[model samples]
Target: MCNRRRRVDLIEPSVVGTRNVLNACLKAKAKRVVVVSSIGAVIVNPNWPKDQAMDEECWSDRDSCKTTKNYYCLGKTIAESEAFEYAKRGELDIVTVCPSIVIGTMLQPTINSSSLLLLTMLKENFVDSMHVYHDSFTEVDDCEKLSSEKLQDLGWKYRPLEESIVDSVMNYEERGLLLKK
Candidate 1:
């Protein structure tokens, strides 16, 4: 069974939900708001220079995303754009963080999409061998490397990728999601 969330399923939560949060922040007179967008929004554009690394400045083209049926990227782009627009109209300090694929021990009992992706990679023959490029998955084969310079400049630090992967694998094993290999 395909675990992909349909475009319709994502629209309300990604677009409308963001609007709701922004409205609530406005109502509460929040001094600052941090919006957690995805790297999907920044990396999908075909017009960006191939030699340049993708940064916060890059945005996925909404029309291109629509034509490609990449609803997730489209949603994030729209939501982030809306947040910035709202911020421009008001005194709200909106900061958007677009993170790449995150892999680590999950806080919740149920596995999330990113974790599931790692899990699928670990399990041999768990999925069909045929390479399928669906709308839910981004084709990163030709994409430029993503840069976190802006975030690092802000004094943010992250655990090594190997450490994160190990933590996630251990968590999965402890939860009986994966057999000891």
Candidate 2:
């Protein structure tokens, strides 16, 4: 029988991961750690202010994640939250970066979920599901615009989205991640 991903699977492991990693970091007397979270932890908030742009301060509402059945978002929300809560003890300086649908070069041999979604769109023009996106950021065709202000503030620079797309396609082809027709 084929197994399926479940909310419990996502949420429980994230909670455990945070516990184990933090414990190890504390035990080793690590001075700092940078957690790479996703924009799912921000935009999944159903109660997001309509006119306000999403920023680092925004967090996905837990109830909203649960209601929308966005298990990844739920997991990220809990994991990042638990990590930050533990970091608040001042024992370690834990910084975090919450990136949005990253449409750029893949560093690893395997394409990431964000790149996979884009490739799927090109091939099938379909997606399994999407989170409760703020209406203002919704686009039926083109990729929606998201504010990367916080990341920018941290000196994170990015190539143009169009350039990134072209580069990703080329990279995918080189890596043979794209299905041959």
Candidate 3:
């Protein structure tokens, strides 16, 4: 589940959504379920354990995430864990696709908080000018580009990334949100 609220307090919604909402999906006799998770579920301290690599076998350390104030990562970790727990108890056909930092044009009238922050920083002179921590592996990529690769593996196709950006720009323009010249 995506973090849609301004508040960082997510334990309640995370519990309700995963337990009740997931059960609802099963009751509706849904054949398959797909949860869009983040790499946050699998990664922590991006530079730690220099030789370590994460796959489906690995899970993020919730304590580490919490202590470090990686609230977003903590949220993803909990939600995905709940999904797996639910799947384990039932014959639920579920798939969790964890992706790295997702970036793309949004269809919504207003972009998400994270996206808005990035857009503001890139296009306007606001916020911190420098980040204290530098991690080479952490870089943003077009959301459509990344998702398309996974979709292709599953025999699905979507529009090109360029088209996605174009659409985003169009949406912004329509909503009177213009990029910096």
| lDDT string, candidate 3, 1-181, tens digits | 3443422575555545666767888889987888877777777744445444456666778888877777767777888889888788885777888866344566465577545654554345422223213222234442222223545687876556445444544555566556345
**Global Cα lDDT for candidate 2:** 0.72
Candidate 3 residues lying further than 4 Å off, grouped into runs, are: 1-8, 45-53, 105-110, 125-152, 156-161, 179-181
- TM-scores, each model vs. reference: 0.79, 0.74, 0.65
Q: Rate the local accuracy (lDDT) of all candidates.
A: 0.79, 0.72, 0.62
- Candidate 1: worst-modelled 10 consecutive residues by lDDT: 126-135
Global fold similarity of model 3 (TM-score): 0.65
Q: Write the per-residue lDDT of candidate 1 for residues 31-142, one digit (tens) a residue.
A: 9999988987787889988888888788998888888888888888998999999989975899998877668888887886788787777665333222322223335677
Q: Could you tell me the lDDT of residue 135 within candidate 2?
A: 21
TM-score-superior candidate, 2 or 3: 2
Model 1 spans > 4 angstroms off: 1-5, 125-142, 179-181
Clashes of each: 0, 0, 1
**Candidate 2, poorest ten consecutive residues by summed lDDT:** 128-137
Error of 2 at 58 (Å): 1.7
**What lDDT score is found at residue 49 in candidate 2?**
68
